[model samples]
Target: MKPLNIFYAEPDADRWFKYDRYPRRLIRRIFRGPQRPGGVMMVAINLMKGLDRLNIPYRFNDYRYINKHPEELACIIGKPQVLFNREWKNPVLFGAGVFSHPIDHAKLFEQYPNLVKILVAGEWMRDMFEPYYGDKVQAWPVGIDTLHWAPQAIEKTHDFLIYDKTRWINEGLPQPFIEPLLQTLNKRGLSYRIIRYGSYNSDELKQKLHTSKAAIFLCEHETQGLAYQQMLATNTPVLAWDKGGYWLDPEYYPHRVQYSPVSSTSYWDARCGLKFSGHDDFEATLDTFMQNLHNYTPRDFILDDLTLEKCALKYVDIVKSISE
Candidate 1:
């Protein structure tokens, strides 16, 4: 069989437009071996690793060069805009969705059937898009690169950690979500640091997390929430919101509630971390998380459930199904 052709959009200046579906450049980490920092890049790298293990012949290229070559069976990651209003032999959209702004699917899909098959990182995403796209959407979790994110024999340096995006302060989570958590941490007299998503590269972040006891995650919404999984991969437990604000009523707490493509909860398993609705029971939740932190084996959970090899096999299966 011929190899699967994979195309990813090149990171460029113009790709950062208001509602473009291109990948954003996160922190660049100087790490040796099979792991890099960015979530999207890591997904690509792990997929490549899976293909290599299976001896599958494949080519990786920038989406810009896709039209320059002859048409054939191929898989596209990143932006699907390039494939729109055009024709191709067979195209697969892996981990594709709108990240920033709303999409007019009625107009876009009506214009061109660019996406033939689609794979998402979570079941919730599939549920949200399936009604509009029909039987084309499938749930395929992008598992973690365990080798790069596994736990180590390191001493704990801080009592707690706050893992979040830098944009949360400005755009995502406002004072309603932030102030209560900060007050709780301060009241407990815990030594903590807020590590923004883009602030540190993989190696740097790994080092910080290795020396931390626990983490609290704040984000707008998550399809897969790779960063939270990465923290879990390091055996550091997390406390995160259980529900997406999009489904919640706007009247009760309108400050941080925002729209999202899909509703997903990533860091609220009993074996990994804790969950909270709002400031109502946050203190109690924190108390429980702190009390049960030592018993949680989050790294083991990732190893068993979300390994890259497992995810790759699923990807291969989907490709085979679609190809056949």
Candidate 2:
């Protein structure tokens, strides 16, 4: 019997440490990690996602340094195989861990006879990849690093805790949410601090979230919302727009994650999350959220299964299927 092999072909990137919590023991091969962030996929953050539970004991092989040719990428294989994306070819059996680009999996199979399948993150992303790979692409949201984002025992306040990007004010909605939210909050004579972790320390972000009453994220669109999940884990009430914005923020469609109605006033319960459409009607939604903020003690949830650890296991299973 022979041990199964898998390659962990990390890019030449930096901040790989940010994902240090992600398990790196599942591979039998490696190409050294990258030297900087945003290497391949607009930032290819995926390189280090779900690092919290990375512990599958396996051998790790070294990279074959070539003069200048691009690093040879070995996909979803357990055996040590070497080939260029152009020369050595095999039908792509599946795109289990593949992200969506402007291409489809079938065409991917056609263009590169070696590509047989592709599993994307979600329906939105699938649309991007389906055109290039065809029926080969599917959506399967990846997991996050939970251990670093779990709940803790801490004292909290009963006030409005709005968690958002710093741009909320400088980049307030030209004529909508932001501008109105500012006016709305001011009129009520309420004082709340907006926490933006653009480049802040993790400890600091955690501290603010714990003390605050709720976490609010109102953005355009998101594919997968990592921060939202973390807030949920902490039991902090969440407020955001519907349909999620930009993949950079983990998006939750169909109300999977909780987001307070950006236009509601009944925000006292911090159960799952509240949500509102980013539509013109967001004003009312914001009003509702503001009202809810007036009289609510944030509550937490028992999100044990949704942890990043569990998410990683599911991803590993997809990888294993592709390998098999």
Best by the TM-score measure? 1
| Clashes per candidate, residues 3 or more apart or on different chains | 0, 62
Candidate 1 regions with alpha-carbon error over 4 angstroms: 11-38, 62-71, 85-87, 97-102, 107-110, 166-176, 247-264
Supply candidate 2's per-residue lDDT for 18: 58
Query: Model 2 residue 121 lDDT?
Result: 42
Off by over 4 Å in 2: 1-55, 58-100, 103-107, 165-177, 243-271, 279-305
Write down the TM-score for model 2: 0.59
* Residue 274, model 1: Cα distance from true site in angstroms: 1.2
Q: Tell me each candidate's TM-score.
A: 0.78, 0.59
- Worst lDDT run of 10 residues, candidate 1, spans 22-31
The CA lDDT of each predicted structure is 0.67, 0.46
Q: Cα RMSDs of all predictions?
A: 5.9, 10.2
Please list all clashing residue pairs in model 1, or write none if there are none.
Answer: none
Model 1, 1-324: lDDT tens digits are: 666777655344445576353233332222344334365556667787877766877878644455565455567655554355246645545454333222345343455455557666677666656666677767777677888888889999898778765233244555545777788889999888888766677777788889999888776567778888888999999888654546332332246433343343642357788887667888999998889889998888887788887777777778788767
